[model samples]
Target chain A: MRAIILEQVDRLLAAQSGAAALRRLEAGEWPEELWEALEGLGLPLLLVPEELGGIGLGWADAAAVWQVIGRYAAPAPVAECMLANGLAAAAGIEPRGGFSSFGQTAPFGRFAAQLLLEPAPGRLALHAPGAATPGQNIAREPRDAMTPGPLLAEGALPNSHGPRALRLGHALLRAALIAGAVEHALALAVDWANTRKQFGRALAKFQAIQQQLAVVASEAAAVSVAVSAAARAVDSRGLEGASFEIACAKVVAGEAAQTTAATVHQVFAAIGITEDHELHHTTRRLWSWRDEGGSERAWAGEIGRNTLAQGGAALWPDITARDIS
Target chain B: MRFELPSLPGGSAGLRAELRAFLAEAGRDWTPAVRARSWMGFDREFSRELGARGWIGMVWPKAYGGHERSGLERVVVLEELLAVGAPVGAHWIGDRQSGPLILRRGTEEQRRKILPGIASGKLAFCIGLSEPEAGSDLAALRTKAERVPGGWKLNGRKIWTTNAHLSDWMIALVRTSPAPEGGSRHAGLSQLLVDLRLSGISIRPIRDLLGEESFNEVTFDDVLLPEDALLGQEGAGWAQATEELALERSGPERYLSSLPALTAGVDALRDVPGADVAVGRMVARLNTLRGMSLSVAGMLEAGEAPAQEAALVKDAGNDFEQRLPEQIRALLEPEDMPEDLRALLADLTQLAPTFSLRGGTREILRGIIARELGLR
Candidate 1:
């Protein structure tokens, strides 16, 4: 990672800043200062390219930065901002201020600064990626287990309704960020292992603990390597490798992060589950990070689609081409 | 990186094709039932056929009866056999690795005597490392091998010796010396080729939770062997065992147990519902995993030990594989699934529980991964 990224990451983590300060961010709104400070570092403009007044780093460097920020359990839009900005730049549009979410159409387009509908709209048309609803949710009532929500982008956004384009940049960036989060979870587990003790000795000495931690560490490292490698390949091979590489990397990393977070929390014993333990934040961040990127199943499904389309054999070279680097 | 299913150099493709044809024909009648395809599910006939093609001992030189093919090429063969669910338990240990170990470390006579039969697919072998109490704790092993006139006399019970009752020979870890306080307890465990058929040895089947008898508990009652039985060197078993395990503990076999159920489900639905969508996802995951796996194999072919990389493959691949059963549950059970699919899922759920256990537990797998990351 670049020293600048690390410095910026450390500065935020130094204060445990952002929505992290809120007791229940899963339900609460994001803070204003955190967003302002993040933009001040040009985080939102990261993918804007130097030509677009942004400090454009390669995906590997970007992934590493995301991992560091993830370790601190920062809020959603930090990395998301970077990705949306990149997409805006790629579309050759100068952004005013708006965020983009990928996948099928979001109803309200809450974060969308402007809609680049898959089917480019004709003049005087306010289009909608039609029939776009949020992922299936629990029935709303006291009779059922209703998930608390000020749901982000729940209903349709005015007249804009139709099928949408797959935002490749958003997908790729989310994968990278998720991979980074998995790496972060592994690190948190390692740090916990070093300091946490049981039976009058450091817990790191336990065979069960060591092996689990090692697996988590290895997974994150390998995926981190793979994701970065894929990112580099994107430059050389264009989009071919990036999709599969990022998809594979993200799915692997996401699964690892999900499992590792639970495993680490388990190893931390009862204290880890409490709201105040430092470990709580690690797992919480992992939770949010995964939801932000969709679930592992979603990404795995995408990977399967891309992979089957390319056939298994093309995957290696597809991501390893000269354009990827 | 994506991996191309490489054609074998020279006549290797022909050999793979021949093996593929043989397995396809042999398994034509195989259903989820009547097929034990566990460690004991090895096909002696298939082994003999592979021997006939001179495909075994593939990584070694020709002097010892090996085909001298590249490891990368051999990976394709290994993967296909496991993927196709071929009955390869008979000669798997010998063909896949024991032959290479003996060729690498055994004397001329040892290589000549062992390698030829292995290549020809006549000989069979099994590993003996775990004990009744030391299944995952290799350092806790109490099996002792004492020095004697001609060679060492082994006396101790070896537990979880896969297919020991059926094996002709064994590559076993026996304690030759004791560990002092805080010493490397895993040290002094020598690896030797213990002839299982020799007198005074007892093999007992340790039925797994699946009711399969692939694992065994073998007690060596002063089992005698000549000086030549010592593999590599005395007191070198720990490293040798670790090396062999690096081969055993990783590979497509580590995670491909669910492949059959996956294949069956996909085939059943291929003509039905949106099979294209479902199959594509599974194929993509398998492809990426295969890519990573092949890269490790390439590293091994280039003489780079890919233990950690292989561990990553095993962990991720197994996790991915395990999820396949869960993924297609709905399609399989459309209005409450078929008996076959239910049984298939049940079978996979039962048998694949220890995908991470037989070689090394999932925790052990993780330790290897973490260490590679410089975190521990």
Candidate 2:
């Protein structure tokens, strides 16, 4: 079932969300068709329960789908809507028909009918999207600062640390996306290395290029594993319970995004620096997405401080406790 | 190329707790410098105790004196031991690769003779792969063995043979026949089980940068081995040894070498400024590496030879292990640092270079990954 879902999503995104679509998105054109196609697959409600009039899926499944979204650099707020819809269902708020963005600075906020926000520590408020100060990230994805007009619904969150948990969830989403984008970039770089000839041989035939690509592959693998593990942790344990894994995921993904982007760009050389090539679509997103989800430095600081407070003896036990059967 | 996270089976928590408790009690007298040795800290008594408790060879069948535990169970035991920098060197190679290799490819007599002893921690084994001339290009090894009437006469020199002087036996990869002209250089190589006490065999310890003589240069001059000493099929040593390396490279030890330094630094830098961020970065990297390592272990458990994935883990893991001490050093105020932490930091910094050099070098591992990427 997971493979089927991933396959369908991969196929759809490959066809509909290519370089032309990305260029359109960067030019401030909404990917209405691509968004509708994704919605047709019931992706927007990916995390909502079946009883809530949506297909119920776990974070692991969501992670796999998000990877596909990242693979094509899909210019739609599919992940955001999925997360926001799930949060609405969890809070017993009626799922809106149109897009629903999460947090104040959600992508495509102007297009969303509702915004899910943590107004208080344990309270979740669904507000109608009001006036927006439109913004764009490095990849030109909408990061609008939407002002909440009026509260439509409010309810208690399932866990304490609601705001922090929601932030971590956002971080996990970006980590998954970064994992996918970095992987895609790696693929492009490898393909280019094999295709482009220089000095009467392919770039991949050179030891220096091979070594750099090897590091890129290593980084890609590390982030992929980190994000998957984090998703599994969230599946078995709640966001609060899986905080450690989520933080690690964000950190690892963020770090890998930097390393992978730099090396892959280097591998693509002058062609990569031009907008005509497809590598920038992924690398720019990697740069933007890495800092969006708390950054590696932020999470690393938290992990370090927490581990220090627990002292040396508790470090190993803390790491061991994360492994669930 | 995607690593699926493996779920540890039930009872892993209990197993980890038990191992942690044992390590705590057993390692009470160990100093910071001693723990800094990581897996290189050798203690026969500790290995024996772990064997008695069925911590060693947890994944092998019970008939071979193993506990018939799961591979994930074994990973839990190993990570627990390595996390605390326990002295597991005495039985490390035997439990990790040699015994498992023997069980998989050895004759019945060989398995019966060697495995139980390894599981009981009464026997120690060292690998004789790197010769004075051959380091990463293992096919360049010239260690030769000639067939005799009823045994083989081994004549060769093996360098960087860890624990060779203290081990009871050495699993030596030797040239059973000259490489066929214009043919594969890997052909005609074979593995032989050589007793260290054999006549005309000599071992000389070489001190490392950390001032420890844990590895040795071993020379065999016409050492006689019984005909049954052949570990696996003759002329299959290259494949066997490379397979053994995948197992060796994909363990917690690959990433946990500098963990003690991080831990010690964390304890001393609690009141220091900006320490939490540095410590947290290390912790994050450690957690991710553990996840990758565990996934590889799961692949091994399922009988999958994830050699490429293992090389990726080792290369990234080596980077983390090597950088940890330097990162910790950058975070510390040298004058305000505790003496124990200072000494450990110094030792780890010196030992950091060996992390990438051992098992496989950084360049070799990347080459393997590049090959997997179809770049070679």
Candidate 3:
């Protein structure tokens, strides 16, 4: 089952390589063909329940697809769609899937078929992307802000007054995406360091370059593990209790993505910054994703506040409680 | 590609609960300062208690007093111990590296003699690798041992040897012969087990900034060891030592040293605005570091020598551990903190510098990782 999921994602990512994604972004267009292919594979319904007309995979399994999409910086709302399907499943709504965006403020609002908005906890209003004032994020990705209009469908989620689930779920999604991009960025940096030479020696032969690459590699590795743990937390405990681990994953992965982007790009100097290169696609998305999940400071504040609330003695148990086997 | 994490083994939950129960009672009296030391806090009685439960040498064969548990089980126990600030330091070196090295490389007679003692926690061990001039560069060590009638005679000086003064034995990496012509710098090195109570040996405690005498410098002047004391083959010390360095680098001790301080800071800041986020941020980083470290343990359990990944974990773990004190201070700087929290922070601040210095320095660990990445 894991192999099939990875192979399926790998096939799509190979079809939509980094270069292709970069071109689409540069052309200011979404990859309709890519979205169509993923939707044809029932990709967005991965996290929805089997009873809910979806494959019923856990958040961890669903996250693997997002990681792959982030690896190539796939120019589609695959994450948004997956998230929307998940929310819809939770809300007992069958998402008539196309490219859908779900967030406090959904990006690519102009391209989405339906927007899942959680203005308050437990109450989700499905609506068309109305009044989406056109805007672009730092990465030039479609990020139009919108005031959620009249609901197409609305329901009260049980024990949903607190939006911890949405907040933590978003953090988990962004963490998976950021980790994937950072891993690829590190791989690219390693390739550059090992093959690129200066003064008749490979850049990797230089201690300075090696150190930088090493730092990025560590960051990438750290982010991957953290995201994996967070995914597991969500898989086991649901969002209500998993927020601490999710917030941790977000802060750690977010911090790592920022450092990794700077270090990996700096290792390439001018070449990485060029439009002809696909490295920017991953780095730009990293920049966007890190900020998307409330940024490091935002999540850090949540974690800090949670820890402080527990008092000093209970801190160990809080951390140990997440030690899943 | 190797970054894919391995799954934690089954039965870890049961082991974790057992350890937690033990820790709750054992560490009931430990203050934050005692907890701040975490794995570095030594208590002979506590170590023996763990040994009695067969937690030490858990992966070795049952014949050697081991419980024959899986590597992941050992990781679970160790992680719980460090997380709860258990004082297992008296037997930490033995359980973590020395005993494992002996079990793998020691002869039947040597294992029979040493392994049971370690497993019983009756024996304590300390590393004798670093010299005054050979901190990061192990091959540059000048410690020498020469063939003698019944065994070998050793002469060397080891610095920054943790717990050497308290340990019953020392595992010394010595130059058995001069480096061969045009040979690897690592040639002719051997690991010899030395009786710390040998007549010719002397141990002097070296105080750190925290005024702790846990670090020591030891001198060996013509100490004699039995023939079987040689671990593995002579001149195979470098390869042998490198294999277990993963065990040293990937343990929870690498990251959880400063957690007590952070947790205390969390308690102190509970009523402060935004304290959840502030303390939560540090907790989040720590949880991630634990995940990364646990992944290394998984790799080790699969019998894959993930030296580079272990290096990555240690490098990342050290950075997190070292920065934690300062990060907590920065987060809670505006608020007037309690006295206990203030004291914990001060202690952690002083000890944080040692995080990257011990095991392998950050530069060296990164260099190893870079080399493994095919970068060097």
Candidate 4:
């Protein structure tokens, strides 16, 4: 299964090279081919039940796909569609085929055929694009906003874990994305160190560069491990006891994204800052995703409140007692 | 991908509960200051009690006094021991690396002699890797073991040898021969097991920042050993040391050092304004570190040498543990802190500086990680 995921990822990345991706972003192209390829692979419907004509992959499996998409900085609604299909399933709405976007404010909102929204707790609704005021995240990917009114279908999201779960799920996916991008950034840095020579030796041989790249590697490893924990927690507890893990994972991912992106840029120096260099593809998404689900600082506060609420002796157990089911 | 941190295997839950029960009973009287030592707190009686319960060397073969438990079982025991701040330090080095090294490299006689004692917690071991002049550059060590009639005559000085003053034995990496013809510095180094009680060996304590003498400088002058003292093939110490160092660098001990203080701080400041935010951030970071550490444990269990991944964990773990006290202090109002909490903070603050210096220094760990990344 992982091999299949990796193969699909390789194909997608090959199709949308950094040059093609940057061109699409610059030209404000809709990434139609990218979306088409992902849809062809049924990547977005991974979380939906097999009964619903979906693959029914678990959270970890979907997250693996997100990690690969994040690595290539593929500007598509892959994460959103996965969440939307799940949300629609919970709401007793049959998710239609096409690009679907779900969030407080949807990404690629203008391009989405259907937008799933939770304007308030327990309320689930679908809306046409209606009007998507085009906006871009820090990475210049689409994060357009649309008015919540004039819903095409509206009802209470029965059996749903509620808006918080959706948000947590999105946060978890973004963490995976940032993790993937950091993986790319670290690879780039390693390649630069090995190939870019100075002082009659590879930059990698220098202690300074190695130390910096080591930090990047640590950050990458941390986010990768952390996101898995969060994914597993949500899978088992259904967000009832998942907030702590989710918040912690988000904070770690956010902080890692910031630190690693900056450090990779420092390692690459002048060339890293230019758009022509592919480092920006990953680094910029890192900048954008760290803030997307919720900023690290925001999640830190959430984690802090939860910890203090649990009081003293229950703290460690709460951490160690994560659901492995 | 299956690259995710694998969940704990079955039977670990029962082991975790068993350990928690034991800790609740055994650690009832442990003070916050003592608990702050975490894995470094040494108590021989406590260690022996754990051994009697078949906790130490839980995964080794039964013939060598082991329980033949799974790696996750051992992880559960160690996790509980560190979490509640048990005094496992008496057998920490032995059970963690020394016993494992001997089990892997020692001859049948050596294993028979050493393994049972370590599993029983009656024997303790200390590492003798870092020398005064060869701290991070271990291959540059000048410790010489000249070949003799019966065995080897050892003469060298080892610095920062943790628990040396209290240990019964040591696995010393020493120079057995000169650099090879091709100038490979790692060649000709070998691991030698030395009895701390041997004549011509002196151990002097080095006071750490907290004024505790957990570290020592051991000087060996013409110490004689039988042929059995040599571990593994001669002139292969570098490879053996690499494996030993991996075990040393990857354990939960690396990041759990300052956890006691952090936990106490959270308890004391539970209702304080914005306390959650501070405690939450630390918990988040701690959870992440724990995940990374456990992943490494899983890798080891699968018989994979994730040396670079282990190095990454140690580098990050050291940084997290060292900064924990200061970060917690900044989180809470100083004047509002209780006396017990303040003492923990102060003790950890004093001990924090040594966190990165021990095992492998941060720079050296990072260098190893970079080398694995194909950077060097």
Candidate 5:
């Protein structure tokens, strides 16, 4: 945990120089150039297995990168790209070059060489101009809503082409999202408390507010711990066991994100909610990311129901260090 | 009466086998949904069946319709119930604490009146200690009941009254006097058994974010109950409330609510080559928690007060419960899933936010633990 945290700190230190772009992101500006530079620096492919000539990091490592990404509030698709590539690498496949994903909204042509979408039917070939090829140019939404578009294209590919990388990589990305959002929210909150004056005293002096901030700190750290455990599960136990840890990871970490963001807004008050503040960017992104993969309650009911069916104990097998070893 | 239960008694294995046979029949052909009660919904009949099997109120003496089981023996029964998600919700409160409370304090007549039904699984109870104005602050309650002829006329309201509408009786707290000039007003509060059938009493369910109708806005208006309704002494409600809170805060239920989702999560990976090892790690932590909780129960059974330990266990368990939903979601649908699963996952994930808040928010719990540790 300490090593991973230190690695994250190093990542943050490297990105510290990108502070100016972070400010622009707060103003709803998508610094595509800076993001492009980050991708060039291999920050986007941080979770691609080392076997794939990538960083070969786990959920915790991805979380560390995301923490750095969060500090700058970078309006880049790093998490999105990592999610796409991580699973492909895991499944012994490699997806090279630029691909933008079509999730909730369509991402138009901006900085991508290709479009990434879930599998579609042959109907596109029957209807569209790129019908002769295996794929067609399609536009989709950028991960960060604030990103500006270059152009739009409407086309689709065959149903067989959906990227497998997103399957496993998505969890890592979501955890990164939570970790990033929490760090940024904490930063925004701590800054406000330190500088903002209330009743001729800093807000930090109030016990009520102090207690609230401490809770935020503890929750974020706890989620971070849970996510680290999930990464360990995947690394040690492989995919089958990793799912259980992931359940715990998403629920706890997601709540940490939601609670931290909500509390950050409350602690900062009017200033935090405004478009001009960094808090808005982190909070809004958190809202979008929380629903992207799955919600916490869905997982709880699932975990509990599954335990009941077992008619014994929960799914803790006799895992030893040698298992992962 | 400190009842010592061996960690791995010879009877335990035999009892487990017997319970399996009994539950297989009692729970025969029961729908899977009914078996997994905490997630699907609560059932009363199943609990009654368990009661008939002497499972409910298993710890009390046989004279009270109980099985007079030891602590370890009772633990086996409870572990099976929770592990299988038996619809024990109806009898959960009654069996866990209400039966014990009645046995400890109620007059012989009151005990006979309630314990038999409770042991028979005919009664459901909810605690009405929280009010809209008073949540974490239990002693600050203003719901007052004055001296009247046949009984005391009640007039205050309680919020977050879980299953109050379905419950036959509510063990509630009300202020018997003015705030008492800040000299530890906790002593002036009193507890009463308000039968839900009274016409003057009203229970309006409070709709929560989850759209679950578990909470009720219980209103008391000129409700009269016989003075024999008072449990213990008038000035003793505070102590009683503390003891009840400790009981409430302790137990496997605190951590086990998310067991179903966790099970589903592990199940999805069962066919995978490496799931066993991962499941083992998760299970180890859960077992560790369960062990701690059981040890606390053992302490409680030994006549040792373990409020701080209970609070710690509850908060830690809830913290884990709150994490289960999101982590599972990430595992199940690491990326964007199909539209329907996504919708279902969204609801479950949203449901995780309140686990910490429902029992006792993390803050209040931390405060309790801190006070226990003498850190305050």
Candidate 6:
């Protein structure tokens, strides 16, 4: 099932999504056809329950999808809508999803029909977007400030699932996306190193280039493992239960994003910094997404504070406690 | 490359609890300084006790006196021991690589004779791969084992042989024959299980920068080894030894060597204002590396030789281990910190350089990774 889903997503992205489409989206042109195709696949309702007229997939499945989306640097808020719809269902609000976005500060807010807002700790309120002040991230994706019109639904989040739940969800998704993007960037760098000639030889022929790519590969591999483990944790345990793994995933992915971006850009040299190159499509997303959900520094601080509070003896146990085996 | 999330058998909580209880009691008297040594702390009695509990050789078959447990179970035991800084050096090599190698490639009599001792933690082993002239380029080793009347005659010097002075046996990679004309340098190598107590063998301990004599330089002069001492097929040692090195590189030890420093730092800086961020970052990296290590172990259990993946893990893991102590040091104020924490920091600061050097140097591991990436 995962293989099929990932294959289809990869095929669609390969066929429809490209640098030109991304550039159009960034230029304030809506991805109407792409969004419709993704909607037809029921991607936005990925985490909604099967009984609720949506395909109920586990977090692990969502992680794989998010990674593909990131690999293509998808211009739509498919991941955001999927999570928001899932959150709405969990909050007992029936999904009437045209397009949904979730956050304390929503992304693609103007485009989303419903905005799932964490009005306060332990409270979730669904609202409709009224007017928006257009904003954008470094990747030029919409980060519009929405003036919410009227509340659609309001409910209290369960004690086990509070603000941290939303935070972990966002961080986990971003980490998954960054994992895919960085890996794609690595592939780009490897291809560039192999093809581009310098000093009468391929870049990859040089030990220095090989060594740098090796580090990029290592960082990319680590982020991939970290997010996979985090997704599995979420599948087995809820947000609070998998908080440590999720936090670690976010930190690892964020750190890898920086390292991989820097190395790949260096491998590409001057041409990579230009907008026309395919590398920036992924690298720019890496720079933006890493700071979007939660920065590595923020998550690391949380993990460190919690670890310290637990004391030295508990540190090992805390790390190993998530082991299902 | 994608690492599939490894799934372990259920009921690990019970195993972890049992190991934790045992380590807490056994390690009660160990100070921060002692725990900092972790795997380098060799204790025969401690190993025997663990073996008695069926922890050593947990993944080997029972015919060789093993417990026949799962690989994940062994991972649990190792991490538990290393996490608490248990002295596991006495049986680490035998259980981790040699015994496994023997089980895979040794003769029936050899397995029967050697594996039981290793499983029981009664016999200790050390690798004899590196020589004075063959540190990173092991193929350049000049160690020769000439065919004798009834056995082989060994004559060579092996340096950086960890536990050589204390171990009962050494698995030495030797030049069995000259490379064929214009052929591979790795062609004529063979591994021999040599008895350390042999008459022609001499062991001299080499003190490291930390004043620890955990490694040794072993010299062999016309030593006689029985025909059965040849482990696996002759002239296949390069492949076999590379496999062993992969095993050596992938385990929790790659990343957990500096854990004691981090743990001690956590204790000392528990109430410090802004220390959590650094500690948290280290913990995050440690946790991620552990996941990757476990994934590799899963690959091993599934009958895949993830040598390249293991090299990548060790490369990244060693970086984390080396940086951990320096990060902790940056957070510490020596005059205000606990003496034990300060001492552990000092010890780990000296020990950090070896973390990347011992298994395989960072450069060599990266070179391997580059080859795996098809770069040359």
DockQ of each: 0.14, 0.84, 0.63, 0.73, 0.02, 0.80
Which scores higher on lDDT, 5 or 6? 6
Candidate 1 error regions (>4 Å): A1-166, A197-200, A203-215, A218-257, A260-285, A293-297, A300-325, B1-26, B33-39, B140-142, B178-184, B202-213, B268-299, B302-350, B353-356, B363-376
Model 2: DockQ score:
0.84
TM-score of each: 0.70, 0.98, 0.92, 0.96, 0.54, 0.98
Off by over 4 Å in 3: A51-53, A129-131, A146-166, B1-25, B28-33, B331-337
Give the poorly placed runs of model 6, Cα more than 4 Å off.
Answer: A155-159
Ranking by TM-score: 2, 6, 4, 3, 1, 5
The superposed Cα distance between candidate 4 and the true structure at residue A1, in angstroms, equals 2.5
For residue A50, model 1's alpha carbon misses the true position, in angstroms, by: 11
Tens digits of per-residue lDDT, candidate 2, B235-315, equal 999999999998999899999988877777778889888888778878988988998999999999999999999999999
For candidate 2, the iRMS in Å is: 0.9
Please list the residue runs of candidate 2 whose C-alpha ends up more than 4 Å from where it truly belongs after superposition. Answer: none
- Residue runs of model 4 more than 4 Å from their true location after superposition: A148-163, A323-325, B1-3
lDDT of 6 by residue, B1-376 (tens): 4467687779688899999888878888997767888888788998899889899998888999898899988998899888877878899999999999999999989999999899888999998999999999989999999999899999999999988899999999999999888999999999999999999999999998878898999999999999888999999999999998878888999999888777778989888888988888899899989999999998888888899999999999999989987887788778987887888878888878888898789999999998888786
Error at B128, model 5, angstroms: 0.8
Q: Write the per-residue lDDT of candidate 2 for residues A41-110, one digit (tens) a residue.
A: 9888878888887888988898889888888875688888887787677777768777888777877787
**lDDT for each residue of candidate 6 in A5-62, tens digit (9 for 90 to 100):** 7898888888899899989988888789988999888888888888887788988899
**Number of the predicted model whose DockQ against the real structure is largest:** 2
lDDT of each: 0.62, 0.87, 0.81, 0.82, 0.61, 0.87
Estimate the TM-score for candidate 3: 0.92
Instruction: Judging by DockQ, tell me the better candidate of 3 and 4.
Output: 4
> By summed lDDT, which 10 consecutive residues of candidate 5 chain A come out lowest?
A123-132
How would you encode candidate 4's per-residue C-alpha lDDT over B1-376 as one tens digit per residue?
Answer: 1234867877777778888988999999988778878677778899899999999999999999999998877977887788777778889999999999999998999999999999999998999899989988888899999899999999989999888999999999999999978789999999999999999999999997778888899999899988888999999899999998888887888888887777777777777777766777788889988888888888888988777778888889999999988987886777888887898888888878888988888998888877777777
lDDT of 5 at B351: 61
What is the clash count of model 2? 1
